[model samples]
Target: MCSLEKRGDVFILTITGDSDHRLNPELLDSITAAVAQVKSESTPSTALITTAQGKFFSNGYDQAWALSDPARPKIISKKLRLLVEDLISLPMPTIAAVNGHASAAGFILALSHDYLLMRRDRGYLYMSELDIGYPIPRWFVQLVRSKIGSPKIWRSVVMAAAKITAEMGVEWGIVDSAHNGIEATVEAAVKLGADLVGRKWGGEVYAANRRVVFADVLAVLGSDETVGDSGDADVASVMNHKL
Candidate 1:
């Protein structure tokens, strides 16, 4: 489901597939395991760059699988929250090379990174919950608010379900830079990662600073609040109303 490669101090994680990589338990577990591997092998100067192959970075949850089991939605939600928390507290700098569309949970995943680089030729950053008829998770809202600087852009993303292209993302300060294609975007991310690694900052110190910076987001992710209490209903509503 994913592969991790190391080039000097930079670790590149690729979600391997030609399809819309869905956030199902199996795939999520694979990603989390890959991250754990990165964490275990990390050095003080190590950096990470996450990207994916094909037309989608991720299309959010596996709706069919989620609908098949009554308890699956909460399972995925909790797993996603845990993954975000891990990313936030990772011991090295991280970047997302957005090679394709990132929607809903995928959007949150990308934003969890410390920096973002996107492909300009195609794909977009989209928040699909509004159009899909699901309530945005409270932790998701908090994360987006913390990362996205402009209220207008955040509203457009969450409320309008806007498909934000690379240029717009850079202009709005959500993306660090825009490259011409998937390869170029990943290359840029690697270059940026190398630059960060050259700083040779202490990994624990960097992680501690990130935790302080995103304390609110961490708090929300750590909470025991259920989806309904967070203004989100069951994933069945999405399955029934849309897919």
Candidate 2:
């Protein structure tokens, strides 16, 4: 589902394939495992860049798979929540080389990074829940609130479900930079990662500061309360709406 490669002090975690890297159980587990590996093996100067080899960075949750089992939605939601926690607590700086479309959960995954570099040639950042009639999760709202500074932009994203392009993403402060293509975006991310690694910042110290900065987000993710009970009934409701 994914592979990790180290290039000097920068580690690249790539979701390999031309398909939309759907956030399913297997894929989520693979990503979480990769993050754990990065944590265990990282040095002070190490940095991470997550990218995908495809036309889609990730389309979103694997709804078809989610609908197959009543408990699956909550399972995937919990996994995503934990993965966000892992990314936030990661010692080294993180960047997302968004080479393709990032929708819903995929958007959240990209936003979990410390910085984002997107391709200008194609792809868009989109939050599809509103359009699809799904209630946006509370933790997701909090996370988006933390990342997006403008209330107007936040509304556009969560309420209007605007498909944000690379130029707009940079202009709106959602992404650090925009590049010409997928390879260019990844290159920019790697360069940015290298620059961050050059700072030689202590992993523990950086992670600690990040915790302090996003303490509210962390708390919400840890909380029991969500948009719903995240139970079978909740999953059923969600599926019904989709239908």
Candidate 3:
């Protein structure tokens, strides 16, 4: 479900296959393991970039799988939340090279990165929970607030479920830039990562700065206290009827 490769000081993580990369136990575990590998193999000066193959960067949770078992969705959601926290706290600079459509939790995953670069020829960044009738979890809301500076864009994405195109994403600060294709997007991200290497900051120092900037998000995610209703039950209900 995931692969990790290193070239010089850059680590490239890719979600294999053309399928909608869903956040299920198997895939989540694969990603977690890959992350662990990256941490072990990387140095303080190393950088990481995450991207995917096919038409979707990710479509978010595996709704069909969630519907298959009573407790599956909750487990997946918990793991996904942890994954986001891990990404946030990863020491080196990180970038999301979004090559295709990213929806729902997939969108959140992309936002977890420090920088985002998207393919302009196709795909969109969509926060699909509102349109799907899923209540936005408190931690998610906090993340949106911390990552997206424009309230207008945030409302458009979170409240209106806006399908933000690459150009619009750049305009709204949702992405650092837009490229003509996946190759270009990934290339740009690598270049940006290489440039950041000049800072020579240690991994812990990089992560510490990011944590402070996103303190609220980290607090809510790491507290082990329920910030609010996670909407896991609601998600299961929707999956049961719709998937």
**Top candidate, metric lDDT:** 2
Cα error, candidate 1, residue 106 (Å): 0.6
Q: Estimate each model's TM-score.
A: 0.95, 0.96, 0.93
Q: Could you tell which candidate, 2 or 3, scores higher by TM-score?
A: 2
Q: Which portions of model 3 miss their true places by more than 4 Å?
A: 222-235, 241-243
Where model 2 places Cα greater than 4 Å from the true spot, the runs are: 223-231, 240-243
Candidate 1 worst ten-residue window by lDDT? 224-233
lDDT string, candidate 2, 23-90, tens digits: 98899999999999999999977999999998999998887888888777778888988999999999
Model 1 over residues 129-175: C-alpha lDDT tens digits? 78977767788899999988888888998999999999999999999
lDDT of each candidate versus the true structure: 0.88, 0.89, 0.84
| Pairs that collide, model 2 | none
- State how far residue 181 of model 3 sits from its true place (Å): 0.8
